[model samples]
Target: MNESISDLTVRKHRGMWGWILISLLIAVIVLAVIGEIVVHRAMPILKGRVIETLSTRFNSRVEMEGFSVSVRKGLEVAGDGLRLYPQDEVVAAGATDPLITLGHFSFHASLSGLFVKPMHVGTVHVAGMAIHIPPREMRQQTPKGQRHLGKIKILVDEIVFDDSKLILGTIKPGKEPKDFELSRIVMRNVGPDAPWRYDATLVNAIPKGDIHAAGTFGPWNNESPGDSTVTGRYTFDHADLNTIKGIGGMLSSVGEFSGQLNRIVVDGTTETPDFSLDTANHPVPLHTKFHAIVDGTSGDTYLQPVEAQLGGSEFTCSGAVVNVKGKGHIIDLDVNVPAGRIQDFLQVAVKTTPVVMTGRLRMKTKLHIRPGPESVSKKIGLKGGFTLEQIHFTNPEVEDKVDMLSLRAQGDPKAAKPGAEDVHSEMVGEFVMDAGRLRFSKLNYSLPGADVMLAGEYTLDGERFEFEGKVRTKAKVSQMVASRWKSILLKPVDPFFKKDGAGAVIPVKVSGTKSAPKFGLDLHH
Candidate 1:
C-alpha cells in the first residue's frame, strides 16, 4: 500500500513538470510570431506615421521605401531610401501669386525612441531628391489670399539629387524666362539637430561649374530676428561669367571665384537681414559687408540700405526696393570719391587702359535709378580738384615727352544735352610750370606751321586761357611760320606780326569751357 502511494505522488510531480515545460514552449512561439508581425507589418505603419508627421511640419510630400523597425531593446526605424518634394506651391515675398510648383520628392531617415516619446533621429539620409520649379504660366490658378508659398527652409541629414531642373520667370516687362539644370549633386549635414550645418558639393550644375558649400543654420528667436545665422565657405570652380553677366557681373569682374560667407543672419521679426561676402583670390577680390532690417510679420520686400566700403572706397545708398514690376526700387544715391592718385582714378575709370599719371583728384556725384533698371543719373553735380604734377604722354608722335605741369579745375561733370535744361557747366583753373622744357618731335600748328618751343604759366577759365612769360623759337621757325601763313592765308590773319615776320612769343591767353575753349596770343612788340 505504501509503495503504490509513493508512485502516485511521483507521477503527479512528473505531470506538473511536463505541463510547465509545454507552457513555456507555447509562450516562446507566441512571442516570436508577434515579433515577426511587428517587424514586417507594424514597423512599416510606424514609418508611414513618421513620414506623415514630417510632411506636416515641412508642408511637403514625403515617402520612404524598404522601411523596417526594430524593437528588441530600443525603438529603431530605418529605410533604404526616402524623398521629399518642394511644397506644391510657393510664393515669393510680396508676390500674390505662387512662384514655384514642385514635383514629388523623397528621402530616408534612421529613427530612434521606441521606448521614449517624441522619437529622435539617429541618422537621416536623403537620396534621389529632385525638385522642380515650374515656369510661370499667364493663366495659372493660385490659392486666394495667399501672399506667397514655397519651401522657406529644408532640413535633411544627407541629400542626393540627380538630373534636376529649375525654371525662373519674370512677369515684369523686358525680361525673359531663365532656366537652370544640374546633373548630379550630393549634400550632407554633419550634426543631427543643426541640419543646416551642412557640406554640399554639386557637379555639372547650371551656369557651367562645380560648387561646394558648407554651413550651419538656426537657433531662431523672436527677440533677435537675426539670431538664425549661417556661416559657410564655398567655391565656384570654372564658371562662365558671361552667362550671369546680367546680374552678378555688375559688381565683380571675375568668371571664376572661391570664397566664404563668414556670417549671414536672418531675423524672423525684422524686415532686413545682414550678410557679408568674403571674396578672396577671385579676379576682382570683392569684400563687401552689408546690414539690413526686414519686417517679418508683413511680407514687404525688404531693401538692404547698402552702405559698403570697398578697398577704401565708401558708398552710401538707400531705397533699393523692388517695385511691383519685379524691378529694383529706385533710390537716390550720393557718392564721394576722395582725393586719390590719378592711377587709382584710372583703375576706377577704364580698366583696360594702362595710361598712368601721378596726381590727386576728388569727385562727388549723384546717382538716380529705379529698381531693376540700369544705373542712370539724371544730373551729376561734381566739384573737385586735380593736380597733375607731371603729365607725360607715352605716344611717341607728340613732341612734349615730359610735361612738368600742375593743373587745378572744378566743374559739373555731365555731358551736354540738347532740348533740355542746361546740362553744361564751366570750370576755372590754371596750369603752371616753372623752368619747364618741351621737346616736340613733330608739332605743326596749322596756322603757322612752325617748329616752336613753348614755355610759360597759363590761367584758364570758362572758354578763356592766358599765358604770361617768354616763348622761344628755333632759327628756321621764323621762315617756316612766314611760309605757312602765306600758304594758308593769303592775307595775314593776325595784326600782331611785325614786318620781319619773325616767330616770337607775346602775351597769350586762352579762355573756354571744355567744349569750346579758345586760345589767344597777344603779340606786343
Candidate 2:
C-alpha cells in the first residue's frame, strides 16, 4: 500500500510541472506577436522623418507612396515613388510636375542609428531619379535666419545611381528644356550643408561622345540651381565630328572646369589627327588649346581665345558657338594669322594633291559657318585680305615661264630662255569666299621688272582661273624681240604700247586649269 501511494504522488508532481512549462512557452509567443504589431505601427514615424528631412533641406514639400523596413539583416529601408515640390507659392500657383522624383530607393543603417536625431546611414542606392530644375525666376529664396521647429537631419556615407536624368528648364516661351542623360553617378559624403565629391559618366548629345568626370557639387541652392557651385576635371574621348554633317574627325580632349552651374570656365586641349572637310576629303592634323566660358543651360560656348595648329600653320581664333531656335549650332569666329604658309592652308581647303602656289602669308578674316548637309566649302563664308611674299608656282613649267617673262621684261631678250633662272613674285589681295569660289576685288602682283593689277575669281577645285589685268614692263616693244630684223619692224608700234609712264603697257588675261595655265593678250577688252 505504501509503494502505490508514493508512485501516484510522483505522477501528480510531474504532470503539474509539465503544465507550467507549456504556459510559459505560450506567454513568450504572445509577447513576440505583440512586439511585431507595435513595430509595424511605428514604421509611419520613420517615413515621416524621411519626408521631413528632405522638405527641410530643399525648403519644399515632400511626398512618398510606399515605405517598408526590414531588420532581418542590419536594418534595411526601402521605398517607391518619392517626389519633392516647390515651396508654398509655387504649389499655390499650380505647378504641373514635381521638381524632383525618385522611382525607388533603399538604404541600410544600424537599428540604433535610425532612432537618433541626426541619422547616419550607409550607401544609398537609387534608381530612376529625375531632377527638373525650374527657371531661375520661378523659384523663391529661403529666408535668411529661418529655423525649423523639428527638422530631421540625415548624413549619408555615399549615394549611388545606376540611371538618372537632369533637365534644365528655360525661360523662353516656346523653347524646350535641355536634357542630360547620366549613365552612372556616385557621390561620397553627401549632406545638406556640405559639398559632395562625385564621379559620373554621361553622354554628350551634340558630338556623340563619352565623358567621364570627377568633381565636387554643391550644397544645392534651391532658389537658383544655376547659382550652385561646381568644380571638376573631365576626359572626353572618341567624339566623332562627322555627326555635324559637313565635317569629319575623331576628336579627343582633356580639361578642367570651375564655377557656377550655369556659367563655367574651362581650359582644355583637343587633338584630331585626321580632321578633314567633306569637300576636300584630304585629312590634316589639327590641334588646339582654348580658354572658354560655357553656358550649361543653353549649350553655348564663348571662346575667349583659341590657339590652333593645322598641319604647319598656326592661327588664333575667338568666337561664339551658339544655338539657334530652329537651326543647330552656328560658328562665328574672327581668325588671324600673323605668319603662315599658303601651302598649309591649301592642303586642307583644296582637293589638288600638290598645292598650286607656295608662299609666306599673312591674313585676317571673319569666318562664319552654319550647320547644314552641304559641302563645307560651299557653306563656309570668309571676308578677308591676305599678303603673299616670295611666292612661287609649284609646277616647273609654270615657274620657268614666269622666269622667262621677267628676263624679257628687263630688256634682255637673249637671256629669256627657260631653265636658265628662277623668279619669285609678290601678291596682295582682298577676297571673299562663297559657293566654293574665291572672288578678289583688288589684286596686285609684282615681279622684278613688271607690275600687274588684276581682279578675278578662282574656283576652289583648281578647275578654272579667270583674271584680266594691265601689265607694265620696263622694256619697250622693240626691245622684246630676239631678232634684229623683228626688233626694227616692231619699233613703229612701240609708241602705241607705251602708257602709264612705262616703256610698254599691255592688257593681259590669265585663264586655264592649274596644270596648264595660259597667259595671252586681250585686245578686244
Candidate 3:
C-alpha cells in the first residue's frame, strides 16, 4: 500500500509539470501576438515621425509608405514610391506634380533607447528612381525670384540610386522648350562626412559613346560657405567631336582627351570659381588654367580672363564676359597667337613641293557669338594682319642661272578675303626681288635672258587688282628684252626709242582681277 501511494504521487507530479510547460508555451505565444499587434498598430505613427524628421531636416516635403519597426533591432521603412518636393506651392501641370520620384526606396534605421529618440539610419537604398526637375517657367513663378528659384536640391547619406532618369528643362517665352534627359544612370555614395564620391559608367550618353567616370567630390563644409572646393580627374575615350561642338557651339578637332584637374574652388559668397586643366595628346595639347566669377544675383554672366600655354607656345585669350540666357550663351572673346616657327604649318599647307621658305608670323583675332538670339545668322568676322619677310619662290622649271630670290610683302587683314567689294579693301604692299633674274622680268627673251631688277607696288580690291612698276635693262640686255616681247606677242621686236641699241627703260602696267590679270608695256628709251 505504501509503494502504490509513492508511485501515484510521482506520476501526479510529472503530469502537473507537463501541464505547466504547456501553459507557459501558450502564454509566451499570446505575448508574442500582443507585441506584434502593438508594433503593427504603431507603424503609421512611426512612419509619420520618420517623414516629419526627414522633411524638417532637409527643408523639403518627404513621403513614404509601408513601415515596420523592431524593438531591439531597427526600423525598416519601405515604400513603393517616394517623392520630395522643393516647395509646397509647386504644381504639376497636365500630370502628377513633378517631384523627385523614387520607384522603390528603403531605409534601415538603428533603434534608439526605447523609442525615446529618433532612430539613426544605417543605410538608405534607392532603386529604379526618376528625378524630374521642374521647368524654368514653374521655377520663375516662385516668390523667391530667379536667383534661388527652381529644382529641389537633394542630400542623401550612403545611397544607391540605380536605373534612374533625370530631366532638366529651360522654358522661355515664344521659343521652343529645351530639355536634357539622362537615362539609365546609376550612382553610389560612400558616407555623409566622406566626399560625395560617385562611380558611374554611362552607356549611350547624350552626344556620344559610353563613358566611365570615377571621382571624389572635394570638401563641402556648409559652415564656411566660401571654403568649398571640388577636385576631380576625367577621361573621355573615343567620343564624337561633333557632338561636343553642338553642345558648346565651338569647333574642336580632337577625338579623345584624358587629363587631370587640381581642384575647382568655388566661393558662393564671392561668386567666383577657380579651375585648372592639365591635358595632353589632344587636338591642341593644352595646359590651360583660369578663374571665373559667377554672377551672384543674376547668374547670367561668367567672366574669365584666362592665360594659357599651348604646344610650347604662349597664348593669351579671354572670354571677357559670357552671358548665359535660356537656349544658349554669348561670349566676347579675344585671342592672340604669338609669332612662332611657321615652317611646320607652311609644310602642311603647301605639301612637299620642294620650296624652302622661312619667316615668323603673328596674329590677333576676335570672335563674338550670340547663340540663342539668332542661331544660323550668327555673325563671325575675322580681322588680323601678317608680315612675310625674306619670301622666295623657286622651281627647277625656271632659268637655272638664277634659282634663288628674296622678296617681302605685308597686307591688311580685311583685304585678305576673296571677292570683298570695297575700294579700301585693298591689301596695299610693295615687293622687291633681287639676287635672281626672271626670263621675262624685263619682257626680254634672247637665248639665255636678261640681268633684270624688278620692284612693284600692288593693290587688290575685291576681284580687281592693279600694279604699276618700271623695269630698266642695260645695253647688254636690251636686245634680249626686245626679242622676248617679239616671241610673246608675235610682233617685230624693236625698242620704241633706242639710240644705237643702247640700254632702254620701260614702264609696265599690270591690272585686272586675280582671275584675268593682264600685263602691258610702255617703252621709253
Task: List model 3 lDDT by residue over 7-32, tens digit each.
Answer: 99999999999999999999999978
State the C-alpha lDDT per candidate: 0.36, 0.82, 0.41
Ranking of all predicted structures according to lDDT, beginning with the best and ending with the worst: 2, 3, 1
Return the top candidate by lDDT: 2
TM-score for candidate 3: 0.48
Worst lDDT run of 10 residues, candidate 2, spans 139-148
lDDT of 3: 0.41
Better of 1 and 2 by lDDT: 2
Off by over 4 Å in 2: 1-43, 65-72, 88-97, 139-150, 172-176, 373-375
User: Tens-digit lDDT track for model 1 on 267-383?
Assistant: 111111111111111122223343433221111223354444433344444432223333533344444545434444333322223323334334444444444333121121222
C-alpha lDDT (0 to 100) for residue 92 of candidate 3: 35
TM-scores for the candidates: 0.40, 0.86, 0.48
